[model samples]
Target chain A: MEIFSNLADGFAVALTAQHLLLALLGCFLGTLMGALPGLGPANGVAILIPIAFTLGLGPVASLILLTSVYYGAMYGGRISSILLNIPGDEPAMMTCLDGHPMALHGKAGEALAISGIASFIGSFFATWGLVLIAPQLVKVALLFGPAEYFALFTMAFATLGGVTASNQAKSAFAAALGLGIAMIGSDSQTGSERFTFGHIHLYDGIDFLIAIVGLFAISEVLIFIEHHQGGAAAKSSAKIGKLIPDFCIFKRSIGTLVRSTIIGFLSGVLPGAGASLGSFLSYSVEKNTLDRENKTFGKGDPRGVIAPECGNNAAAGGALVPMLSLGVPGSGTTAVLLAVLLQLNITPGPLLFRNNPDIVWGLIAALFIANFMLLALNLPMVGLFTRVLLIPTRILMPVVAMISFVGIYGLTGSTFDVMLMVGFGFGGWLLRKLGVPLVPVILGILLGNEMEVNLRRALQISDGDWSIMVGSPLAIGIWAIAIAGFVLPIFFGKKVKNQMHADHSEVEMEEVIEGGD
Target chain B: MSDRIFGFFGLALSAFYFWATSIIPDSFMIDVVGPRAFPYIVGTVLAICALYILLRPDAEPDWPNLMNFIEIVFATAVMFLYAWTLSKVGFVIATVFATSYLTWRLGSKPLGSLITGIATSAGIYVVFHLILGLSLAKGPLGF
Candidate 1:
């Protein structure tokens, strides 16, 4: 099969000494970034993109490093949840329910070990899921004509704008805005200047690297300043508790791994639910199934730790499926990666299989290696990553800042880029304050061009018959999904929000009467 | 009134999209669709989202950081100066000055930031100019 030979070629690329070293370095750095609280895969990868670009690595090498960091963070996120009751990212939040309590019970070691094994189970299976399903999905993708692509990308944008999080719709908006800004220089279709504003530099459109760094990295720094006067301090704790688990612990929770992996992976593939939902679903499922054990699920149970850890890790892998095959990111992080891939001029979809086999296979292989490496390093290195929490914000920030500056210059040695970074960074800060999620903006920007090109192409074919979108099943299916993606969230999310508010109000009323008496 | 205004804008965008959707030039090679189709859809959706925001304004825009805005403007201004004077002032002076201003804004010590900025500019200049042997454009400001 072509897949095997292509995979072999990817292995040859991945196995080279330079790439091997890069992978290891990537895995190490990825864990370091992942361990940081509140900074998940998206922020972590976005922050260090400049470093990869500065180092002058090709696209393949860059993707491998970034992907490794993504998996590494999933590994490190568990330790924080277990030890500190602080999930490093959203996916790890469910682990905090049982994991932190278990640590207090002196089963921190067991909790951690179980989480490690569960994570390995989740990621391994998810990677294989990608391997088995990617080609088939690619086959399905080939059926999409431009009209279908147009409809699908619009749906992706709609989902991005609608979902993600409550904190920053502007982030997504900003991303799409940035994409539209990038489209300004020369029109790909008409070769006309749309928004050059008389600047010759505008002719080339905006660079994706510059926009990403300015928005994600620089804005992050401004945010840090607003929150911390002196930034996060470094903690280098050298204590490693229990690092390994015996068979008894393994036997007790193997079912949790299987169930959670499936739950996590499936929920993860959905556009809006994301990992938090996945982990929560997994935790409840484990509870319903094992309620008769006379054991508390959330109070310090190993299964509690296992379910979320497995679910979240598997979900990270599952989120990639839609992004890779359909060129639609189910979540914010994948949207950013989608932007990166498009910038490198790789058009993702069924044709990606026929072309760019090296990139597709190489990234896939790197992810497989990243999972195993994460498990191996996590147990022995928990103490070290925990210590990373204490790194002085003063020191880490300056170094990162300098790396960003140097990295931007590496691309065409452009001084003009510094201006763009600072501008977007400030805009990003403003957008954040407005409660706009930056992800959708980027998504809109990314899909804007795709949507535009497809619209033009589709119109040319249909001679301006507006019914082209509704006429075909493939287009109609995408349209239906797009509508569902938008409408379903509002219906269900509103019900949940109202119910939560109702419960809170009842609790408040009860407390008020008692206090008055 | 603000809500109504945003809603009207949303409606306007959607209408504009429908009108503009008709203007895409025909490329008859592919009989399925043309370039105008997606924009027509997105323009329409953006209008819909705009309407959603107008009808249900969950969150409004927040305030910008004043200090960051100042820093951003100064940073952009410095780049403009560099581009205009790159040949005149020479790469080293222009770069050093820009770097100094930025580092100072970034919270470096006045002296340290300036020294380091100059040092960084000079260091890069050395690598790019002397070692790599790229020639700096010598204009009014001589090297």
Candidate 2:
């Protein structure tokens, strides 16, 4: 009864005309960004951060808008995968296994509709799961002390190698680099400058928005430039025969939708296991469980498309649980969201629900509305989004560049910060070329100060005793998990990486053969 | 291999970072753990990771050809120039130059690039400055 009343109050806040408009705008923009091949949720949210600030939207409205984009991007990622044999993002990679085949068979519209419906089912229930789980997780987070919190951050960093990065050593190095960047400003504790290098602008440290936009959006443009020769445009000439799927296919996929949703939701809830893992795991599980003979999996099976689509969307919803409750992001996009919350001076954690109940409940309520909006919007709008794929990179990249420069300048009014953003962009490009994952770096920047503060606090409490780090059982357990999270990845990570590569090549090979024919 | 080169670069960075941390002036009201402690740990971890990378380098990476490399550098230079001249030339003028060059470099015809540049700058100005009421840098001609 209390939960229902809370949700009702939340719905009241979310139903305002302004908030509803923002949600609608976010879903639309998010889908457009998601349909684009390279601009996934993180870059989409990052590029829009300054606009949100300039609009002076309240914390609740800003969050509602951004999170809607997050969910919508997850929904839109399937468009390119089904029609063009190219994934809109990494999580959509699995969709190509069967989605392209469906397109080839003139079921492009059916595939899109089915994926949209499955995504709706997955995200709808997962939002409910977030509603049920986040508050309880907050209760548990309430018990954490400084030492335990420090250990928890370490656990977050340790697990980054498992799911995101290709190499653990490189991931650790990127994290260290991010922490080093965080140390450039005046010390929060002592007001003493650490690495300002005699520059006044360095005193305030690098802004998170500048860093994120630089690393994601700016570097993306640079990459587009370098790879411009090949012109990776989608040429989807497949006829979309029907807008709706056959009833029997939907009936057959009912069990698959439920099973994949559960798998994906759990994957998202786990630290560092994001939508990519969710999609991969759900698709593989469905394939192995149903098609052990491997006859129907990569050969245009509806279940194959349904499984990954459902899983990734569910995982996208599930990723919000840890971020809302514990203040640790569940994925790269959520990390950007966490930065937005911090920028608004609203720290998300156990105290958030108590202190900012309206923002919290309103966001959750808006998520429900956004889900319905996406389901309604995506089905009719598939044709429009497929057209988004046709825009040339020559035009798109310049606009992206203009947005980054203009947005950064607008936010700070400092050409100096703009230059600093460009510097970060170059560094991000270099690191990316070296095969270092950028997410860990962003995570490190976001969480480094907090991690350091917790450690210092714990040490201060114990009178400079290092043993206090392991004094609590909870801390000990978390450290153990951190170690396991780091080490287990080294042993098992190669298999997963190889499998992904294999899948990628298989899809590319099929494309090559199709092109030759 | 590229990894080994990156590893060496990381080592140098970590050494410099550690040296910088050591030279941070001690604050009068510093606690038992100073600001240098966390940075020191970060530098140390970086060194270890870099050392591991140096010892076990990955295979040689696929480097872009010379022309592509030069083009990337040119794009970076254009961005840097745009940032440097943003205030002096104003958002509109500076954006027009940068957007035009970038679009042309990305394979647009000169006329097309010019049109895109003008259109993009005008569009952003209308939306961001006029509608949103955000302040933009004005050139000598002023708004």
Identify the runs in model 1 with alpha carbons over 4 angstroms from their true place: A1-9, A161-179, A229-240, A292-295, A494-517, B1-48, B59-143
- Considering only chain B, what TM-score does candidate 2 achieve? 0.96
TM-scores of chain A across candidates = 0.89, 0.97
Instruction: Give candidate 2 misplaced runs (Cα > 4 Å).
Output: A229-232, A236-238, A511-517
lDDT of 2 by residue, A83-164 (tens): 9887888899999898888888888999999899989999999999999999899999999999999999988888866554
Give the proportion of true interface contacts each model preserves, from 0 to 1.
0.13, 0.75
lDDT by residue (B1-143, candidate 2, tens digit) is 88988999999999999999988887777888998999999999999999999999877777779998898889888999999987788889998999999899889999999999999999999998899887888887674
What DockQ, on C-alphas, does every prediction get?
Answer: 0.17, 0.76
lDDT of 1 by residue, A1-517 (tens): 8767777777876776766667787778877776776466777777666556555578888888887877777777777777766677767877887787677667777777788888888888988787777788888888888789878876775565334234222233344344445455656775555456678877787776677667777677666555442334334452445767766866877788889999988877776666666776787788789865746865677887888888988888888888888888877677767866775678777777678888888888888777877877777766677778775453344344444555565554666776677677777776666556677666666666776777777776778876776778989988888777766655565554454345234434544564588
Candidate 1 positional error at B24, Å: 13
Best by lDDT: 2
